[model samples]
Target: MNLFGYEIRRKSNNTASNLPASTLSYIGVPPVFQGSTETVGTIDTRGKAGQAKAYALCSPLMSVISKKCAAIKNLRLAATTEDGEDLERPDAVRTMSHPNGVQGIADFVAHIEAMTQIFGKAYIVRMESVGLPEAFELFVVPNLCVTENAAISPALSFMPDADIVDYTVTICGSSMKIAKEDMFIVRDASYDLNACGGNISRMVSLQKPVNTFVASYEAVHELMINRGMLAIISLTSGSGDIIRDARLPETESEKNNIQQAFRKYGIRADQFKYAITSMNAAVSPVSSTITDLGLTDVQKACKKEIADIYQVPSVLLDVEGSTYANAKEAKTILYNDAIIPEANNIFSVLNRIYGFEDFKVMPYYDHLELFQESKREQAAGMTNLVNALNNAVSGGLMTTEQAKTELLKYIV
Candidate 1:
């Protein structure tokens, strides 16, 4: 049964269990649980499903949440860890071995290790959907006032006002997909979508740097008057935590308090515009690495486009020709060294935003260089390493029993 539009029973068992206004939506991590633990891990991607199965386990709370959510359908609940585990078990978190990349193995292990450290035995629901669909997608009537030009209206009346190419860019999110426009205020050169999609084009388009412009404070609020922007936000180098801490209440009165707080923190609307501009320009620094990509340049005009992209900042870029005396000096410019300065500033605003860490860059580069120094070493050690893994699993570093069970997932 599709079972769409059916609301699950709430804890209070109210006849109409609409989600609480405070219901935290999932964004990799559910909002209700606030603390996060960041760790380095090795995911076991040798077998395809190994990675997927384990990543969810790393931040195990969601699994618990999913399990509790499944209780409505009477589905069997059977999920655990290296040791006998349960939603209430304290030692639920365990560290996974470290290696890098999104391979079924390395990525999987990293997540497992993260969950072990951060969410060790925290309150969480569990789910079992070996057979049935886990979550339901329902179509409900729109929530809104009957407005004019319902269809043509921009997805969001007030885009989370942001900076694109230095010129204030409105980031309007919409349930209805709309064509995106970009501007290059730096070179006064804007380009529209090339109508192609690939990692190659994602990188090739940015052969030349696009200069982004910054907008004025007055322009930010004035643009909101008519533009159908989705969210009104201040995107900036400032941390996410700082932005989320806004005391703006749901009512207009709250806005005054929020304004005071904004002013107190020097987060005037112009500064908010500055943040978006920083984010737009930030893409170039991210792209300087071997693999970099981002939004199209302006010329196309209009401020509405949406995208989520990542880069492999030229890891250890410019490290050459430096006189290094020791490993400490070498590490000072490694992936962590190269990316963290800018990255930490990006997430410091928020509690712990993912995708800012070093490992997130591994997926875009040549994998073997990750552990070894040269291509020759990678070629020389690959077979032996794979054999070593198999032997170790057969031996006891992990276990033949474990590999036998997990590796079965990748067998075609």
Candidate 2:
């Protein structure tokens, strides 16, 4: 498949109808730097997406954040008037409840959110039938490249809606272009201009921590395979001089015997084995240990940094030092700070695309038990304040207007 004049090969064994071939192929090198030549740095969109996907698959912390944020299933589109009053759900809003025939609203939005988090952007295609205006389908494009129209002038280049012409979507080694009006894009904040303000993937900034995490695991694996070698053994004669190379082994069988002895009788094993040398040689041990490398501390620090970059609470990643109270609070923070904002951003763009003037579709979380508990607590506090104000007015401690003024402060 060709993307921005670059060719990407498809894997030969990828026969699954549901999977995109581009996803299975090696990451393509971007044609050139997207933004201005004077820009300080360049971003490779495909390469970055590939790296992010690998990290998300390898690192537990990153995987947790991506899954936790995308696991939100309580989202619903609600219609409301300009005066903040609830209105009856319109047909457009009802259609969004199950955007496509296969996936419900929750699953559809979850897929979009997951892709956006991993690839820094997601493209949703609007499949409208010829005569059925209300019967439209929505599905995410697995791999896409945005192409700008040549007709757009330099003055209006920053306006993506007008500047973008079509999206080149690659699927199963085939490619097609979708018109701009039929696509909805959700992306993180971007500073790039040449690529229609495409976002820089968050994984680009987390390379160091992810590499450290992987390296630490590799070191442990190597140590286990080597049978935990802790010291370098040296042989010396009884004269306190190193044994000469000529005196060591003269035949292949002798060399193999020495190697076998060392392998069998090295370090602390299930049963202690002794090496018997007939030359009256003395052995010295040069000590080394994995603890001296401090890999555990390094691994912990890397996990913490990865979680911080994704705005995930560290308590969720590592429950060793977490209490029940703090764990609950951390979950609440994750939902309020990361998940809800992202859901709103996607749905708000959908509302604008449908051009609903009488009502707007939005996601609400009042049904969640976490927020429900908070509401009950708030209601109790408000009731106590109202009773206190009433008692003050009845006891002549304060005038009715003064009590009302104080009550307003709390309500607001």
Candidate 3:
């Protein structure tokens, strides 16, 4: 017997009465009681699955965000000294190595980037904790553990009014339960305090724009096909009058022969004009003519909308009106505004897990030398300040030390 689309009873062996009392009670339980304490987690990944597929196949914007964010450098563990100075620790770097083969920081960043891009949040699980100063490996798990993987049990030791405080995660299709301390979670922006994990994807609010881009892309291809057809050939009547055939083809063979003839000489006027002339119709030469669809500008607009969704400069996508100098400025802005924040958010999670107070993962784009031009301009301004300070010192208006102090204000 089937109940609610599930087999509740099968022959004499598997029946509802044979199941546990707890399992039987779940059949009529309200959705609110499905999880503990009335707080529910968002576990459904269908949206994320669609987003991932789109990122993989339909668009390059997600990849651009992920790859650019993952290209961080100079991230290392550091320790704070008694003098309040931060010192990089090489020993700490080696501890970051994964015991599950050769995966390292790069692989970690790639997984994180992809997770954040598709799901808007990520969780790094520590694989083991067996030694002093605990050398452990980190791996990512699905974001929806509370809903998709395990049930939440209320920690009864808490006061009645206190929140659930902690959760134990269990893998589906398994019997083991994971301790709370083994997981480190980071979430994107959310208004709900009780939300298990929240994410704010760049494309989340740009659904309309994404649809427009896709539609415009398809429309452009269709327009191109029509344009190609019009460019290669033309079809016209001897007169702009409709031909009415009183006696149509009575057999399939006759119809096919007529179709073959039309396919051969119907499109090009030069091929069969004499044959039409031999009939009672006067032949007029017809050729393809260009029609303006203004599709180029429309497609450009659509591309710009897509770039805007990711805060990426359209020039990076080969959009027009983007100069080299402006593109350079855009690249700097892109790295500073969008990419760095994401890298910082991921690092925050790592810091919390490793209990590091002095170190952080920072996005490094200095190899691009984005600040060099600004530095040059600053140097020029500083030179003028120095020359003026020198004149003041030479005129005895200010002492050398005083001039130095005045110069330091602007230079520093």
Candidate 2 lands at a TM-score of: 0.72
Query: Which regions of candidate 3 are displaced past 4 Å?
Result: 1-46, 70-88, 93-101, 129-133, 142-177, 189-198, 215-239, 243-302, 358-361, 379-384, 410-412
Candidates' lDDT values, in order?
0.26, 0.66, 0.54
lDDT of 2 by residue, 315-369 (tens): 8878248988988898799888777888878887777766777777788877777
Candidate 3: residue pairs that collide: none
Q: How many backbone clashes does candidate 2 have?
A: 0
Rank by TM-score, descending?
2, 3, 1
TM-score of each: 0.17, 0.72, 0.61
Relative to the true structure, candidate 3 reaches a TM of: 0.61
lDDT of 2 at 251: 91
Q: Highest TM-score, which number?
A: 2
Best candidate (score: lDDT):
2
Candidate 1 Cα outliers beyond 4 Å, as residue runs: 1-105, 108-152, 157-206, 209-319, 323-327, 333-412
Which pairs clash inside model 2? Answer: none
lDDT of 1 by residue, 298-364 (tens): 2111111101011121211221233434433443333343223322221121111111222212111
